[model samples]
Target: MQAFIKEPSKHSHAPDPDRLHIIRLKNEIKLRGTSSAEAPSTILFDVLRSTPLTAAFGLPTNDALLQTISRERPAIQLDHHVRLPLILRQTDRGESFILYEVDSMVIFTCDKNLSGLVFVPVGDVLKAYSSLVNDFDDEDYLLLDYFERV
Candidate 1:
């Protein structure tokens, strides 16, 4: 998937440190476009940018995602467990489903089967587990769709 990165302005003005920093951040994100071999931190950034749903959460290989969330909302502690409503969608297929329940080991998708149950392992969700233990808000959950984009 193509990353929706904004082009930097081509102007020479009084160098504002903050503006330069912002430009650098944008450039860094562009460099880390959706690729096959992605770092855990890049995965987290792409995930958040891909979707508007803010109901996704998981334990990434590193604490980058967690640190960002915590920094954004300090009321939440590091180990707080808050059940997240898993939302899944295939961007290429244009299909969407809501997984109502997420456990320590798996997430139960909206898919129904012979046993009236369909589930995806927690590990498969970008190699992270959704233990319903993450204290993330609806806005914070938008990062979950990064898997489909890549």
Candidate 2:
């Protein structure tokens, strides 16, 4: 599958010091370009940038993915008994998701950094983020995607 990314418009004369972030769905046919004349050869997300190959992952060996997720979400405090997928979304207010990490229900996080990851125990803030991400399983989650700043 082919993948491309488009960054949000607006030159940051001073940009957002808050760290704007978004999620890009891979494997989705939506990112495979289109099958028509005049169609672009690449697909892109206005909020995502093409990631460097070296940044995809250090190496997919011995719990590499899990280790990475843990590194990004050390505060989630997950357990083996909790087996549910958490969908991560980007928001103007911050980062968000629904998962077994905080028991149940979706969580809207303002930050994913070690000190910035805050859990919204209950609220309607995350529902408004419906347009930000496609549903995804939590068997494995990405920590580097947009969570990492340039």
Candidate number with greatest TM-score: 1
Against the true structure, candidate 2 reaches a TM-score of 0.14
Most lDDT-accurate candidate: 1
Q: Please give, for residues 13-98, the per-residue lDDT of candidate 2 as tens digits.
A: 55432222212323222324222222222223221245333434432342433343333332443347563323334443345533
Between which residue pairs do clashes occur in model 1? 47-143, 54-138, 54-141, 55-141, 56-141
Residue 40 lDDT (model 2):
25
Cα lDDT listed for each candidate: 0.41, 0.35
Q: Could you tally the backbone clashes for each prediction? A: 5, 3
Candidate 1 residues 92-114, lDDT tens each?
23433434434454443333211
